[model samples]
Each structure stands twice: as structure tokens, then as C-alpha cells.
Target: MSTKRRIATLIASTALLVGGTVTMGAGTAAADPNFTFKYSGTTSNGSFTVAVYNNGTYAGLAEWNADPVSGHPGDAMRAGDVLSDGWYVKAILLSPYRLATTQGHPATYLTPWKTGDLPEGQKVEMRVAISNGTTTYLSQYYTGHA
Candidate 1:
């Protein structure tokens, strides 16, 4: 009711709001450290490589490919194959599907992979599946930590 009392109440409310926001932000940042997914190289005879990192440390690696089968135009890779590295074929996002003959070439997809939490400063290796057309294969090395 009094002007001085009203000013004090407003200041207290502002302080509480700012303090709560800062606390919430700090908690969230501490709970989730930044992680990254970095991949490179193309399928060589069907194999490819990918890497995962947590806070700039090596988290995991996956190298995989589809094996070429005799007589068949495509490798053994499929749309749902899961490798030991917790990576799997998400979907055939884009390809030369409309062209009947170009189907044997490599296709690209926005692959999605999921894994459990990684302990700080630790890493693990695992196999991942890559596809060339309809064929899929496993990576050669392991590299992920949890």
C-alpha cells in the first residue's frame, strides 16, 4: 500500500526471478555436456566411417559397408540394419531410385543413431552399418564411450 513498501516488494520479486533463471540455466548446462557427431569418408567398396565426440573427446567410431554379392546388382545393406555401434539404417532418404540402372550406386540418408550416456574421459569402439544402394556392411573399427 505504501510507496516505499511497493518498491521493496518489486525489487525482491526481480531478484528472485533473476536468481531462479540463473540457477535453472546452470543446472541444465551441468546436466548435459555438449556432444558432437562427426563423420567422414565415403563408402569404399561399400565401407564408410563415422566418429562421435563428447566435449571434444573421442566418444566412438563406426566403419561399415555392404558386401557385394555375386550376380546381384546390390549389396546386402537394408533400411533397418543395426550394427554393434548402436547405429542403424534410418532410411533411404535420397537416391537414384527413379532410375532403374543407377540403383546399384551409393545412396545417402540422414542416418539417425542413439546411444546411452558416456562417462567423462572414456571412449568405446563399435561396428556401424553403411549402405551402398540396397546393400549394407559393418565398419572395421569401434569408437564410442558411454
Candidate 2:
């Protein structure tokens, strides 16, 4: 292939890869029974809610932001609220090889969660990553649902 053609091909390939990654982490519910799901949010001392809907053709997340920012709903966690905490997303599960973090992401809280098009009807699994602003630690994963 020519230089220009090669560059174009590489760009297209890179775009495809990046696009694939984002879609995989999306919060939207899928028809695939084995598809995984992910969720994220930014909160302070307040708590948030995660509502799951798997009925008919309408299946996705319906999160209610906490007080001072309540009375609204969104598809993405918190929709677009840039709270004190940066962002804490659901964690992965049961991988032999894994990566760890010592200095946690800038967040008021963390949920080391079980995700991936989360299995229908199964309790969502998660862990708490307590951070002292600079350092962090992980907790054992627990099973729960919306």
C-alpha cells in the first residue's frame, strides 16, 4: 500500500478500536444476555441511585442524582454532573491477570464493581475503594442490585 493509503488505513483502524472500547463501557443495556454493562458517577458525602430496566424494548439505566441536584434523571450516571469526585465506575470481575492502583482516581468514593453487560437478574457485584485523597485501597466484591 502507498504511504497515504497506509496512513488512512491506520487512522481508520485506530478509530475503530477506540470506538469499540467506548461502546463496551457504555451504560446502555443490551439484548445480549451475556453482554456486560458499566456505570459511573461523581458524588460527595451524598449517595446515588441506580435503577435498572429490563422490560419490553426499553432496557437501560435510569439514575437519580442526589439532593442539591435531584428531581432529574439521566442515561449516563449523573448525566453530566462534574462533582467534587472525578469519576468512579463499576469494576471488572474474575480475571486471573489484573492491574491494581495505589493512588486512586480523584473521586469522593470508588466502587470496585462487577460489570460487563451485567447478567440479567443477577445481583450487581462491587467493592469499595476507600481513598484518603492521595492513597487508596480496595475492598472485597459484594453482590447487589438496583
lDDT for position 76 in model 2:
15
Stretches of candidate 1 off by over 4 Å are: 1-31, 68-146
- For candidate 1, which ten residues in a row score worst on lDDT? 93-102
lDDT of 1 at 70: 54
Candidate 2 structure lDDT = 0.30
Model 2: per-residue lDDT, tens digit, 1-146?
A: 86434533553465566552112223333333222223344344222343222222222222322232343322112211112333233322222212222234443333232113322233333333322232222233333332
Candidate 2, residue 127: lDDT: 32
lDDT by residue (55-144, candidate 1, tens digit) is 565534433333334542222222322223322322211111110111223333222232223333233333332323222232233232
For candidate 1, give the lDDT: 0.32
User: What TM-score does candidate 2 get on C-alpha atoms?
Assistant: 0.23
At residue 43, candidate 1 shows an lDDT of 42
- For model 2, the superposed segments whose C-alpha errors exceed 4 Å read 1-116, 132-134
- lDDT of model 2, residue 130: 22
Quantify all predictions' global Cα lDDT against the true fold: 0.32, 0.30
Top candidate (TM-score): 1
